[model samples]
Target: MVATRAQLIWIPSSGVGHLVSAVEIAKLLVERDDRLSITLLVLNPPRASKSNPFAELLASVSSSTASAAKSQIRFQELPYEDDPSGLGAKSNMSLAERHKPQVRAAVAELTRALDSPPLAGFIIDMFCTPMIDVANEFGVPSYMFFTCSAAFLGFMFHVLALQDDEGKDLSEFKDSDAKLDIPTLVNPLPAKVFPTVVLDEEHRVWFLGAARRFRETKGIVINSFEKLEPNALKSLLGDDKIPPVYPVGPILNLEVTGRSDKSSEILSWLDAQPSSSVVFLCFGSVGSFHDDQVNQIAHGLEKSGHRFLLSLRRPPPTGMLRAYPEEYENLAKVLPEGFLERTSERGKVIGWAPQVEVLAHPSVGGFVTHCGWNSTLESLWFGVPIAAWPLYAEQQFNAFMMVVEHGMAVEVKMDYRNDLGMETKEIVDSEVIEKAVQKLMKADGHDEKKEKVRQMSERSREALAEGDSSHLAIGRFIGDVFKNIP
Candidate 1:
């Protein structure tokens, strides 16, 4: 074969899930062999200091796990202003039409930063397809990473097509049972469970613009295994509008360093607990909570009497937690009286967590999640039953897949509504949250969900082993997409 020559750039969307998934793929490229040189282009949040905690953590993790491929992996940070809210800052102001301009500006700045050298290809996040035109201008291939499963992809793409052809909007489909005739989907999902991007009419219109841009990518890669979504994979491969679909996943398994010492400490705590006794709660990197919702959630967890771990941030105004409306002490006062005292011994409320390590802990029998794809995979990898609470993006679809289709999770909200404020818009009350957590830990039918996840964990592990399907796909990607360029 010709000597390989390629340089790959990864531009991830905002959120830990996307970043983790992208990093894992980058690691895979380097681990396959030495000929691959990769540039990891991460945008710096305008407000965060040079010593950003998440970035530092990522650097540390990458350094440890990437020894074999260290020299080949390069890190570059570009100043990005995705929103003027100054990274990690949440605002109640709605700027629907204006959001695109800032996104385009960020992409332009990224493209301008890449002016020095031409590479064989660029791997952009699915949400960053505005960079496709830039990739084309530079005569480079732009592969799109969906950052989700094949079934979820099918649902999203199908919704986009409907908007293009039929002018269908979420308002028309809300709470309605419509048969989505997409191939490989196998079943029709309730529109309520679709991504919030297509939830409202204006949002649906906005999505069409983004979807149009996303469709321009040269190829699409998903973080999913073939056995998990075979039919959806087939549909993606069959679609003439898109390039071939590669199901290479359970991406976390690619890590060689495993969990850190702090992570192990938490795991140790879990190990001492009874099997299936702990409930692990984690929203995505960005949090969305209101004060009332937070109080209610706290009360619900306390009442349930289950040992829990709550990873939370202040939600937006009319937000989930009381932290936004009052002083820290005042916010603390909002929890049900005596709730903290009673549960303090059984609870850990850390600001951040080593999620994968926690999930893999034997004591962690259940997960309360925002239903983000990476979290879903991590939980599945550990055979942890999920209590699904989808907030934004493709989370709703993921929740549906886990709870409804796959039967590996339970939906926290059966009748939740969020027509009021951004923070509370999709909020499920704490009572439901409590019930879901209980069900996940121990319920009449929970064994079935637990068993399914256990089975999924086995498959996830198998897919990452040598000569396995995901492993083979990674090798192929290196050959076709990354290797032999210059």
Candidate 2:
């Protein structure tokens, strides 16, 4: 029987990245199936930015679509009446503990709001697996949305499966200089390039909890494509510990909404440059530098003699990860003496640039990026190679995946750690930054690398089109819901 209507609720972990990624896949899901509707039930997170990612998603969902199916998408933010987990006040609670009460509250509220058409399934990021049990209370199937690459997900599951006698835990491996034998990876991963979670005991425990909880979900959805990580996806499926895995990704390449008015100067500057001559620098949302480091980066850009646009901000506040908008300051005060004047014609320094517009421009030949997954995919989508400078979290691992696994980027600093809002032991020298910029921008050594990335760019676009692997995987997932979700 044809289903009259079906609703799916997707709960992303509390962050701009998680929310935006969920919105991407949820939009595609509804577009492919007219019988489907999705509701993004967001829990309140602590900090807010002027360029909030959720606002961008909301705008796109409301206005940018050319299809009639866009109306099937719905959005709601559930306000927690009682602080069952005290998530409102910032504490050191694990992510699982932090999301439980809010997830239950959202579920309860949504249940009460619906009259006839009930939920089909709940889609959640791996960080919010605590919400899976809430789905059981309503007899709804829960699915896992793995936001990271398949290689990282496979390595994590391998670590979680290892027993006391099998090998030492990830924390013990931290002190050693050994490369892990993750069977899923094409090359062994060095301990220095591992994600930040395994290095800390508390975060390691939290990861283990999330990893083990995957087995309880109905299925898993990864934000990656088949040709991108074939072997790792194969390994993920071969393992009995994980549920049926679906590869549906390169999702962050969707249309960006809510770009600020400040981007016009940057885009106009880029358009005036010769095609494939300018390089753009955009670290992740929170990636910024200390004054000395910013000085070094400025010196480097001046020496490169290439047209460039850089998106930079002041450092984040104490005990916070995301940065808030700062009062406008003089560029000369933060950079080296005569730096702005020396490169004034070739370089434009803005407080924040519209990253999607800059990346899409024909003049942008390369990117100097912090290899957050979103930035990495965006560069690939635009066929712009990167000089990878990873700061924290799984970003170091992402850098490895880009340089070693995909050969799409050059490595600048895969092991740089300067995110405690403090001074670093040693600053990356001006010459080092200059060399990497030149290599990615105008060097003859990167032609083959650029060609390969261009090929992958075609693949990235094809994966989301009709009759492609990612599109088919999403279709199959919807079919599974129709078959199993009662």
Q: On residues 410-479, what C-alpha lDDT tens digit does candidate 1 reach at each position?
A: 8886234332222234445667777777777784543887888888889988998899888887877776
> Every model's Cα RMSD, please?
5.1, 3.1
Each candidate's lDDT (Cα)? 0.66, 0.76
Worst 10 residues of 1 by lDDT: 88-97
What does the lDDT read for residue 161 in candidate 1?
75
Please report the candidate that would top lDDT against the real structure.
2
Candidate 2 to native Cα RMSD, angstroms: 3.1
Q: Which stretches of candidate 1 lie over 4 Å from their true place?
A: 48-54, 65-68, 80-82, 85-118, 167-171, 174-181, 253-268, 316-331, 414-431, 443-446, 482-486
Report the C-alpha displacement of residue 23, candidate 2, in angstroms. Answer: 1.0
Error of 2 at 480 (Å): 1.3
lDDT of 1 at 204: 59
